[model samples]
Target: MDLFNPYNLQVITFIVLNGILAISIYITLATGQLSLGHAGFMSIGAYVASILTKQADVPLIFALLLGGLIAGVIALLIGAPTLKLHGLYLAIATLGFGEVVRVIFLNMEITNGALGITGLKSIGSTLYDWLKVTGLTGDSFGLSVLQMKAVLTLLFLLLLFGLVLFLTLRLHRSRIGRAFEAIKADETAAKAMGLPVAYYKMLAFIIGAVLAGFCGGLFAHITTTITPDDFNYHKVVEILSFAVIGGSEIVWGPLFGAFILTTLPEVLRVLAEYKMIMYGAIMVLVMAFRPHGLIGTDTFAKLFDRRRKQAARQAEEGM
Candidate 1:
């Protein structure tokens, strides 16, 4: 069992890409907002970086950041005016924005449109080499290009989850999180209490977009080729679905969702036409049973709490 097998390698890559997109939407979902335009940021990041690296001869690292920045800027521009809206209306508006982005890219001569971008350089082990040089060698073994990507994806997931948890927990424990919860619970009362509803909502949108941009950059590197088809409206829905299927409150839920969902399609591929049907059935089942999602606040608390309670009961019984 050589660890460097290509199939294993591809699976690792898929996990990284899936993890990034899943977590990207997870942030937005945490804010209780559902966006269907996340692919807009993704498109912006992919096209920009691909063009920069392959066309303008920019360095890979710089191209990635530039692409992310471009996407972030676009997201900011769009989010500022739109986050104030609600529900399906917001989803519709975002869906339109995503399509518009896709259409524009499709029509743009530079993008090569529906043909998709190909022949880009693959993201290699250079990043991993740098990590080893910095003394990550003890517990962190050096990796092949694919393994490095998987490790990076895992690391990025951990980092993003930690940062998001820190912020949300701080807010949850503070006046601001209360305001957000208040808004989620009852927007009118929250507004009456002078909560900055629009401001915070917009803040959430922008931050979520930035993360999406970062993920898109990594995505561009991972695929080493891209197309408008890759970041379509369906893709946006997929991102949202992962966050939805996993309860948004679970710190690791979206990643788990990504891992499962990403792997599921492959498992079902043998079913051919029935694969999509099975996928839909699975999702419907999840939604029907896990309404608050797989890890809502009460649910997540109870999970760890259950173990502690069991221990206490055992201790009393022993006494």
Candidate 2:
């Protein structure tokens, strides 16, 4: 079978996009916050980006960044009052916030009410146009335009994911990450130590919002259309499941989980009516047996350390 076929490529693209969304939620969870409002931020980004690109004729990159920044600003506003709530209360507040956002969009005249937005260009098409303008058509790359577009789209998304992953890794090792961990472990003690608990929580919330917004921008461009229903509470649950099933103890877990869960449905398509039933059963079993996910904090670390020790033993034998 052709792996690069359009259907497979679309699925792979969504996997990567969902991986980004998983990371977005992971950022908030890392800070001991249970935010279910990322879907709201995502909707803000999608609508803003769609409007800018479709109406203002803005460039794709600028539209995405602006959309993300706007979402961050909104997060700052919403978080200040709401982050004070803890545990289930915070989750409920955020979930309510998401529903509110959907309702607002659904009624907005600029968003065409419930009709949503469409006719926006795809990311690949935008890239292809730029390439042609630069005198670098598909013929220049010795491939058809469609193939060239696909390759560029994949490469661009991979680069974007790598950038986010790199930043997350840096944050994981930074003082801020430590502060987040401390807060997660004991908020009262963190505040006692004068770690600026509110500031860090707000910062984490804004960062997650920005990331979700960025993901939303990409989602809009990739799908070339978006609606209020797209960012509902169900989407919030799906995004959260990625981190939960993948093991949120480390950064890699959510991405791994996103890949598995996103691709599993396609793999199980042969099951027809039983596809969703099997999928739900698998998730249930994974949660029951491997509560920490398939990869916890020490999973990869232990594997690597064991391999290193085995290599050392072989070297000693050779000597």
Candidate 3:
């Protein structure tokens, strides 16, 4: 394929998809709740989308949404009961849940078990066909549905980032943020403050899980392929890597982390094995050097305060 061919667009598309994955991980991590089972939600999204299309002849776009809905429902089922668990236990439960999803996929006949889903119609192309049904295929370029989806994915990622950021900022600044901070600092204290600790924790989980499901939908359509192995514990670790790297600055922290780590693997292709080694090293250094996290609010506040002081000094000097 040509270098500038549309195939390269997949890489761009995945960066955005993975960015969303990183964003989803960031939400729970911010609340001091570490969920290691993002992959289960993602797998649910992917499989549901594929199954709906393959079995009942569902349209691609609707199937993608259905996949996300399925993931959210599963998350609600898993998250609601488990919200009462502590950090370590919650992490374990999520990880175990992911493993169960993987195992179930491995044994399922319709999913083709370990062989995985294949020959599935690309959502992009499917959209093209559906669009043609409504007369929207276009006059020139004649772009296939996959290309259309890639374009839409890129645009959607930007929109999602904005929407997530806006909501997160609001959440961080609201009474909820203080509650989240209190809970993160001392759950007992938060409860003493009359906060509904369980409810908020569940809320954060639902938000993050829904977003994970959304990202999974993007991944489902973009890759148009998935396997049980794709949603394993290692994936949970990877998403955590993104959250850790992004810092805890409410929003941009995770976004920054996602962008850097998402592209890190490709950037260090030469190092190959050491690339992963170096990635770990970087994470260690970041955690050590900036333990609160790469973009934690504390670090951001310090910088903001410094700038404010500098601005005041400059204003006096000009006067």
Candidate 4:
């Protein structure tokens, strides 16, 4: 199969981006804090990165980092007070914040008032040019310029996702991760045990914001155009579904969820207009059968253990 075909490349790119966004939400959910305003942080990052790259001619890497940093700062500021709220209240407050961000961008002249900034430089083209200048392109690669660009973009995104996944895995075993788990399991008990509940929650919130911001930057560069409408409440719901459907018990769950959800529609393309209806139904069925998600704690272990026991029993009976 031609994985680098434009259509396939676009689908893969979106899956990676959604995986990153899913991880961001999972980070907050790990701390038992449900934040529905990640789209707001993402918008902040997208606009910041887009402006810097388009106007100041900054490098893409630097622009993305700066965008994430700015998003983290905003998360820190708002998370201080809003983090105090729990459950549905927190979700409502965050949803409101996302609306406020969209309206602000819609009215802001710098954002071009809903017209949005277009013609942003494509990272694929930049990478292809760099490779060409470095004498790495041509017959040696056995690929056309377009194919090369698509491969480069995919590699870059995969590298970033791998880095994020590595850090998340390390975090899962870290002291801070344990604190987050404790808080999620029982906030009152965690506080009683002398853990800094508020601080950990804030830290998780900021980290999630930074991740979403980074995702926004990557998304903007890939699409080469971004508007306020790109980061709406619907976007938030989509992101949250990734974490929920994948299962919040482990970091891999959300990524897996993102992969399934992102590609399901494509797989159902034959269904045409009915694809989305099937997609929604599948999600509902999954939720009804596995509320903890497809990969809850010990899911794999139990499955493997059951298989091992069955094999042993069968062997004994045969003997």
- How many backbone collisions does model 3 have? 7
Give one digit per residue, the lDDT tens place, for model 3 in 198-239: 888877787788778777766766666777888887887778
Best by TM-score: 4
Worst 10 residues of 2 by lDDT: 1-10
TM-score of model number 3: 0.85
* Model 4: lDDT of residue 233: 85
Overall lDDT per candidate, in order of appearance: 0.74, 0.91, 0.76, 0.92
- Candidate 3, residue 95: CA error in Å? 1.2
Instruction: Flag regions of model 2 displaced more than 4 Å.
Output: 1-3, 305-319
Error of 4 at 278 (Å): 1.4
Query: Could you tell which candidate, 1 or 2, scores higher by TM-score?
Result: 2
Candidate 3 vs candidate 4, TM-score winner: 4
Which of candidates 1 and 3 reaches a greater TM-score? 3
Pairwise TM-score winner, candidates 1 and 4? 4
lDDT of 2 by residue, 262-313 (tens): 9999999999999999999999999999998888889978999999999999
Model 2: lDDT equals: 0.91
* Per-model TM values vs. the true structure: 0.81, 0.94, 0.85, 0.96
Better of 2 and 4 by TM-score: 4
Q: How many angstroms is residue 76 displaced in model 3 relative to the true structure, after the best TM-score fit?
A: 2.6
Worst 10 residues of 1 by lDDT: 137-146
In model 2, state the lDDT of residue 222. Answer: 91
What tens digits encode model 4's per-residue C-alpha lDDT throughout 183-276? 9999999999999999999999999999999999998999999999999988998899888889998988898899998999899999999998
